[model samples]
Target: MTIPAPTHQDMLAISERLGLGITEEQSKIYAEVVAKSITTYGPVAEISAEDTPLRPAGGSREHTVPTAEDNRHNAWFVRSSITEKSTGPLAGRTVVVKDSIPVAGLPMIAGSNLFEGYVPDFDAEVVRRVLEAGGTVSGKAHCEYLCFSGASHTNVTGPIRNPWGDGYSTGGSSSGSAALVALGEADMSLGADQAGSIRMPSSFCGIVGLKPTTGLVPYTGIPSLDAEFDHVGPMTADVADNALLLSVLAGPDGIDPRQHGVEPSDYQGALDQGVKGLRIGVLKEGFEVPGTQRAVAERVRAAADVLARLGATVHEVSVPQHRLGLDIWSTIGWTGMTETALRHNGIGIYRDDHYPVSLMEWAHRHGSAIDQAPPSVKLFFVISEYVTKHIGYAGYGRGVNAARVLRGKYDEILKDVDLLLMPTTPMTALPLPDPSSGIEDELRTSHPMAFNTAPFDITHHPALTLPCGPGDNDMPVGLMLVGRHYKEATVYRAAKAYEDTGEGAFRP
Candidate 1:
């Protein structure tokens, strides 16, 4: 069965709505991809083609791999159990779930083989929410094995390469979820973030990610981090869609033990209220890096003007101990890692029953080695408390305490600020990082991960990342909005305000 190609009209419609400047020729190709997906051969075509066929300027149909340039893809769309149809707010839209969440009947391997036959007893809390919103589950999004590595190249899934290019990495553990959304295979996706998993991939893939305030969404049937930072959040292409989904997903999930007494807010209403008169804080640490991407900075600066026009005030602010966050997060972050790793029978395999390899062994051998350390990436804490810990991966009492102090500083800073704004990545996406360059690719690729998103995880605050503009190379860059503890509405209002102003792109 041949998948139908997106009609020329379909291309025009999608292109207009998404604002992606696609050529008529590219549109035809995209339609072809869609047409082919509904038939029985759809699954076979997805993995068997190795790549799609491409025609040159002269129309010679040469073989072309399905890369990010496709803007649409079905090949290699990793996933979990799917619903042929959608049910709520995101109805008709395709979505992918990260591996950590339970999807009945699929291999809910959590990126490791240890639990291959372990059918989830039930749908995850977020899974229930997505289906209720009229959204269809496309597949379980591929992820770093066990959601352990920041880079997406786990042995089980190979590397979830950036759709932009084959050799480059899509920053992860949430890597596959981000890739699917970026590739336009799905409307949006879900991922769990304990540290920078959600934020980094969002930033790296040139999309948007929202790590809701702790307990905003129920976490039943999903894995947990430190009991401090595990959050299941939305990762999407548009800021508006993210706001839309939050409305559906945010609510009391009696199942998440962490939500002991927390109640979620009305996120949709908050978006309409917008950011006028809000105080958007500039986290001082975000721009402190050398070689920070100027394009990203310019867009954020322009965003401030839009906010000002929308009636919000922009001010530069810094927490007292931004430097110490590295220490605290490392300690706290890794302690959670070791403990989480200990939960698995295959600290190294995607399916423990089907595959017997240990995960850490694989990661240690293949994960981004710690050779390319950026001046700002701190690993002293991640190593000591998490990675190598043998005590069931429990090792962060000290770092967790230090993180508390850092949180206190952020709390004081937020006392007067409605939301915080920062450059999502100090630099835009670079070429595939070379770890042999003497630093961990993880460190270099994610210098801003700790400073931008990690602190919120520590403070129990909600944060969102938006694509502001292209950096020097025209690769996407992002801006961040962080709210005070559980004040996601405020953050939503502020970002929506900036988006409403329409002054979002870089002028140059």
Candidate 2:
């Protein structure tokens, strides 16, 4: 395809919009120069627009949108059987990916109608790794709209129901992934997290979720909210499966800029190692967050006691800066999401990454429809846009600086303690909001649940959420274990030790 050069009239209109104040004669001269300069774009445009054929290692692209009868929880967006290898660590394992990630021929809707029929021509790095490791790709699971909410009701298909109780929230934006794994629909899942998306849902649904250290897992081929905070990791029914999946998914692919010297480790090897002799710190500020239920906090404290009984030295530790995590994450996340994702069509500039050009084009075409998004998505857009226009980049800059201080604070505490323990969420699963609810009701249910988990995301620490016991109404309570950067082995070891007690299982 030939590149179309801008006409002199087009240049004049562009100049006016940019407030360039150029004369008509200058526009004509500039248009001629631009035409010559853009002639070099012809080959680049031609290559980019050309169709790139896909060669999936094991899975078939044939799929179907599951019917209501088959999707009682509204968990699956599309169902298919995709497997490449027959023998490996993940052999015969069913793995469902969150809808936010690309899976070759399946629609990557990201829980929004803006990308209704858009399908990727290639697999995300994680998906490719899953198939290569002999894991069967079951299908794509639905999530919160554009992954903006911490509650589950915002997905376009429907509210993802919790498997444990009726009409309860499953958490977001990895709502479906958690539900499916809990329901035995899949053995494991890959979930993305910006503001505790993976851990929140897993906590609510009583599954194991790990948010590996920032940059430990390559985020290539997945759309991001903010590159710095973006993470994709494993969700499973038990700690061992989570560790197994992490073993396959972690490591750099040399494409994503987020991976900073990341090296995959023997995650499975660390699962059998008990918490004996480890100094586990119970973070005081984690249980002190507002909206934390008394029962939930007590449940986590009991889990900490179990660790102490198992030969680990457990004691309360406080990092006061933990309270400010959400505010700092909000400032950086909102500003980065608006400028990088919404403005740049999910592929921000100035990075060496495998740009999904087709996805970018689709986003650019449907960008205007964002106004019709769900309440949570709309709220983020409004707040982010306001921050960009009125507060400018200075706000985001300060957030980045504050994040450094917060990280240092955690690091200082981590120097004394081998791992930090806390409640993954302040409370159990919230009830699903009614459809007739107004914007305030919708927004209320969606936000404020990430107070405990969001801090680790910014600090680049590894955090794992495992069910501690039943809480109010017999709802599952999750105890989180946080480890130093790139020390997922330690996090998994503690979580596995807790899981071994058979106490995480709720008999309700």
Candidate 3:
């Protein structure tokens, strides 16, 4: 369906219903931002003023479903452009960007205090790609601090709340990006997924999140996380949008030394090709870990059934090392965190990298230590090893080799199945429990960590997180479809099939 752009009145109502926290003037300003960045610059101030659209009475679920309605995000280049005269299939579509990456003069915060007033010197590779393809950026998004706050809040910016209920979680690092797309405030959003940042938020917010194979796209001009753990991808309401954005954003830039020889493909057109007669594999082992809500499992299985019904031969398979993925994921993530902690500290790019001083001091004070304990502690030990050891270049080499095994497994898995299906996040959106509450802090609500996300990063394979359904609390659950190294088109085609079958909705 050709969805129309949202009017200012439509946006204020949506912002209220979806908990967007934007004032009507801000909505007007947002559109003005779009006009300021493009060919039409003077029209925003000239537009007639009107009262905010009255909130619809207890809006229906149709209001919740995305319809390409986006107006609140148009200000200050929140995302890429969408206009009548843009370009091909994805031309005239508005796209949103995480503020971390450079988009010409837009401030590239990288979710940190250090770059407090830093605007980008030039467009990041992804931004150039979008512009070249006729897409205009609407505005930049707010992100978690250093994009490290897994619960998706930023001390430097603001929270992107859950669409189901404003009081709940939106899942993050890429927090605002998810909310924008899930609430139909933008057609597509570009976000980074390190330790499931993109997928986690996408799952919670009821949208599609693609955690593309690591290195499939350039990671230059952004703060460095461990190169292996970091990946850039798209978040959208549907596979068509996901594919379109990927087509624009995936490729090598000269500045990205790791980008090497890899290249991505045309994703939007591939969705229409369908996944009939393809081999589909359901990840049987390690998909369900602690806190995997029952509702999540049911929707994933429902999506599997849809794939089978569509003539994709479905088989349940186990990746014995997927368990290793969880363990190594911590090593992968925490080590990157430590490295980021050090990298930012050394460079002194942020405003307050000074205080929170001696993370080593903090680690020593609040360090998790035990004489003898559970298998999970081994992960802590690995982190401790990273903290104590100067893992510099050689340690990195070993980590890369360890991660590549997951890639080898992906190669094997894809040989038999055209794509692998798994749940994106183990549960759905959660309550915003106080992070300071010791009892609440111990709860493990998010389970879609390395078990589902790490492998794709390690293997450099493309994976898409598609909203399958919601749990008991009405928080969204995402079903993930992982494709071969460069075969994102096939995966999107398969995902679109299942998405259309209504398997992506809540089960009774």
> Model-by-model lDDT, in order?
0.65, 0.88, 0.65
For model 3, residues 1-508, the per-residue Cα lDDT tens digits are 1224456777688788878998978888766554445543235323412211111112111111112244332112233332323676457777778866556555555555545555444455666676667775776776665566555433344445676777676777787788777777678888988778888888878888888766777765455455656788888888777877887778866556666787767777777777778898999863566567777888788888888888889989988887677666655556555545443441123221112222223323323332222222234345646555675445445666777777788689789888888888777777765546543342343333335666566667778888777677767778888888778888888988887777676332
On lDDT, the candidate that comes out on top is 2
Worst 10 residues of 2 by lDDT: 51-60
Tell me the tens digit of each residue's lDDT in model 2 across 59-93: 45888999999999999999989887899989999
Which ranges in model 2 have alpha carbons more than 4 Å from their true place?
1-3, 46-59
List TM-scores for all candidates, in order: 0.72, 0.96, 0.72
Q: Per-residue alpha-carbon lDDT of model 1 for 259-328, expressed as tens digits?
A: 7667677777787886666887877777765557667787677776677777788888977576566556
Which predicted model would earn the best TM-score?
2
Q: Candidate 3 overall Cα lDDT vs. reference?
A: 0.65
Residue 461's lDDT in candidate 2:
91
- Worst ten in a row by lDDT for model 1: 52-61
**Ranked candidates (TM-score, high to low):** 2, 3, 1
CA error at residue 451 for candidate 2, angstroms: 0.6
